[model samples]
Target chain A: MKPGPFTYHDPTELADAVALIGAHENARALAGGQSLVPMMNFRYAMPDHLIDLNGVSGLSFIDCGERIRLGAMTRQRDVEFSSDLQHAVPILREALLNVGHRQTRNRGTIGGSICNLDPSAEMPAIMLLHDAELTAQSTRGVRKIPMNKFALGFMTTSLEPDELLTEISFARWGKGHGYGFHEYARRHGDFAICSAGVLIEADSRGEVARIAIVVGGLGATPVRLSAFEAAAKGHRLADELIAEAAAAASRMDALSDAHFSADYRRHLAGVLTRRAMKSAFERIGVAAYV
Target chain B: MSVNGRTYERDVEPRMLLVDFLRQDLDLTGTHAGCEHGVCGACTVLVNGRSLRSCLMFAVQANGASVETIEGLANADGSLSILQECFHDHHGLQCGFCTPGMLMTLTEHLRENATPDEQELRVVLTGNLCRCTGYQAIVEAGLDAARRMRAKKEAAE
Candidate 1:
């Protein structure tokens, strides 16, 4: 299906792009056009103007320093293949592989995925895991938002019509931090039915010094299992401890759809939480206490 | 737009998808459009040398960009390219609906990782869905093409 007619604006400068979108009431920024284009084709999104960011300069970059920063227009495939990201934040790379296929990732951008805020998107869940900082730019000025507060609901973000997500930054994990990402879909490269991402750091005693688990595709937005994290924190890695955490995680409310019942997703939430935690612990080179 | 090494400039509507622009305006019908929402990879093309779903892009979005479609997969002398020949030699295609997309996708994949094992080849082929041949022949064809391309490069050097 063809999309509705709209004026296309290709702004060569970031300022010009912002100004263009700010001036139009129903204008939408075009990042990778992976999600928005499909929605527009179906007339689900009927923007009167399209502000294409591809022509905007200086918005596609990956910088790794004290904190990792990714420009909004950076493609997912670029992140997947980046040696810097692979070294500094391997979890992001691992999660990115579970996104769409190579062709889609070749065109999908990090900003697009985050801004679209699909309940099952990997980038948002990864952001939740790292407490990633997001920068939004508009004609007014710039506002920094924590990733947790960025997405308001399903397929909805806190981004104002006049604003564009400019950059995302996350702290580099310290040494000995291990990350695990796992998602269950009907087929390879499909959207997850239930997904889990775990980050663990062992203290001197090799117990669970710090842990964060974020689950996606089972709720209106990516959910941070804080209760589960708190339950497992400072506890020795053991089957019983993991089960307790998983059970707490499963108790959280999740969405139910035609494909998966709520009970099934809840079950998956528990199973995936356990698996991700185990995988993360293994990466840290520690055996789970039987 | 410079498509298949030929430059053509035409005013297009923002609503017009690249696949439509290719088929209707440019008459480059080799690039098939299937499942316009991007689930099926039949509308795949190379935008600036990277594989992209043409169906998911507006024609205007591709303005001033270089696009390579299935029409350019043949040699200038009109013979099949090595990848295409491998498909024919290995019976990679049955109904031929997904052949073009498969070709464009593998063309990009083989360029990056010249030699992919069978498992890796299957992983790469997951993007393009072929209804026939059960994917075994397609994987074989992709592996065979990678070998031939590597050999050709080695011979040239």
Candidate 2:
């Protein structure tokens, strides 16, 4: 399986890369080449030009400030290993470890993962959980899109052909924030069958102060359960409340494929949601009814 | 590209994957192309001292990068490397199709974590699949290699 012939452009500058993608018709930006290359080999994608972003500078970095600014080209392995990121947003690390294998992570970039936008990919779910923002650049200018809006559908994004995903940023959660991420896959490195990402913050009275719950591999994109969040808001951590949240998740219109039935995915979604909520509450020292 | 400490220069197609460039053009066939889609990890190679699936990368992408294939894993004196020796002593391989990738993956893992325990080694080897031995001997070999590597490092220090 060989990728079809294409003209390759390795631009060292961000502007040049943007220009290359803009000027070349049917051009695809090659970041980690993890997803695109495999698709190209299968002839699922055949771009006439490849704008290689590997040589682009300033697109692979992590800066901690009021908000965490992650360059699009930052490798997944770097995110897993970054002490700063682990301290700032521990759930990012938790989710990254579940992505692909160590070798793939070494070469796979964070931006590439988000741009790939696999419904089962952990990065999109994590971003959705954090309300992350993505910066897309083109010759015209730069525009920021929320992670929820950035991902349109399976393997589809709002990014135009000429635009490049340059950076992703999310507000840093304050101290006392507890995060839990869990995914079930057939194999260790395989894509998730059903996964859950949870963020929990409890008040002094052990009541829910802030929380975000997003489930992946259940739909075309990671689905956020706002109804569950609203229902659990201001409620004490209790078995009934957790059960209600899980029930709400089960009602989502989860996707059904040959490997998993819609009814089963609905069941697992509830189970995983309950598990993630329990783990998140436990991390905050609030005993959640398992 | 300087592969295994040897330099070679040639014009190649932009879409030519690194695995094809190595096996077909350079005659370095040790890096097998099992899945050719980055799942099997049989085409794993060291690009600039990091393990990468050569099948997922273009030759032009690695133009200035130094590469290391299975052919480079042996000692300069032509003896088996410590990791390779451990694999042999522990029967880590049977069909030997995935051995090159397993060695390349472990080489990078050992370089990072010189004293990885059995559990950690198993996690590291999850990317490289081995069907023949059910991975018992491979896990043992990885732990043995880490022990030997750490001991040698301690002696040098």
Candidate 3:
């Protein structure tokens, strides 16, 4: 099945796009058309109007200065292979590669992924781990929203009808930090049934500075395990610490879908957490090679 | 609109998918639609030199875009392109549904890299799925095509 009849408009300016969507409450903004088009075909969603953001170029850049700024329309493929992201935020690069296959990554935009707000998305988990900020634009003006507050519920977000995600910005991964994402899915290009992203910062002498363990594919939005991170702080990636964090994650209300039960998700959460930490440890070892 | 170096103009519904517009409307059925939901790569096509899921795009959206489908790869003499020949020689296709998309994707890479390693070939052919042949033959075919294309180009130079 294909989408129902609709009018298509390619707006050049961001402001113009906002105006178009604001004028028609039922209109849908087409970012990458990855999630939207699929639903439209099966009649899951039927918007009468579609406003394309492709004409408004220059949204595919990743700027690095005091902070890392990623344009909303940046394709996942670009992020996956970007030397800038590889150097500045290796976790994000890792997350992007594990998104979909190469073709989907080439067409899937970051804004689309965040706006879709899939609970199992890898990049969102990384965002939660780093406390990233999302910038949204509307005719009213631009406003920044914390990643935690951006997603409200399953496939739901705080985005207003008139607003569109314009950019995502975050502090570059702190120096002397090991970042990693680990997840498991039924297939190589499929969404994760359980996923976790970790950020472990170390001091000059290799003493622990701070750490964050955020898990996705577990709730309506990505959740950070501050308690687990705090428990592991000042400690190394020993088996005991990994087990403690794993136990902590196992106690959270992990999501249960048709693919996985809550109990199984909880179990995988602990396993994935341990694996993510192990990956981080290896990443720390190979930092000098890269 | 100009497609594959030829001009084609036709009326289509604004909501009509590009793959449908090609296969049903324009009668270019070489572009297959496998999942229709964009999960399957059967509806792959080149839009302005970039590979895209035609199932996810509206025909109207491709108004001024340059499109190249599997049918467009043949020459005036109706001979198969080097990539197509390699697919036959290497036993790459089975079930035949995924062949066109695979060929289109493989050709694009061959045209660019001319010759690619096995790993590179596998990466470029990732989205196009084949239920049969175990993908080993497909990668071999892609490599075979790329090597021959590179030789032809070098010989011409």
Specify the highest-TM-score model's number.
2
The per-model lDDT (C-alpha) reads 0.89, 0.91, 0.82
| Model 1 lDDT at residue A49 | 92
Q: Which should have the higher lDDT, number 1 or number 3?
A: 1
Q: Per-prediction interface RMSD?
A: 1.2, 1.2, 1.7
Backbone clashes in model 3, listed as residue pairs: none
Q: Write the per-residue lDDT of candidate 2 for residues A202-265, one digit (tens) a residue.
A: 8888788888999998989999998788768799877776788788888999878989998888
Q: How much is the lDDT of residue B69 in candidate 1?
A: 95
- Best candidate according to DockQ: 2
Q: Report the Cα lDDT for residue B59, model 3.
A: 83
| lDDT at residue B25 of model 1 (Cα atoms) | 96
- The alpha-carbon deviation from the true structure for residue B61 of candidate 2, after best TM-score superposition, in angstroms, is 1.1
Q: For model 2, what is the error of residue B128's alpha carbon versus the real structure, in angstroms, after optimal superposition?
A: 0.7
DockQ of 2: 0.80
> Which structure among the candidates has the greatest lDDT?
2
Q: Residue B90 CA error for candidate 3 (Å)?
A: 1.4
Error of 3 at B154 (Å): 3.5
Off by over 4 Å in 2: none
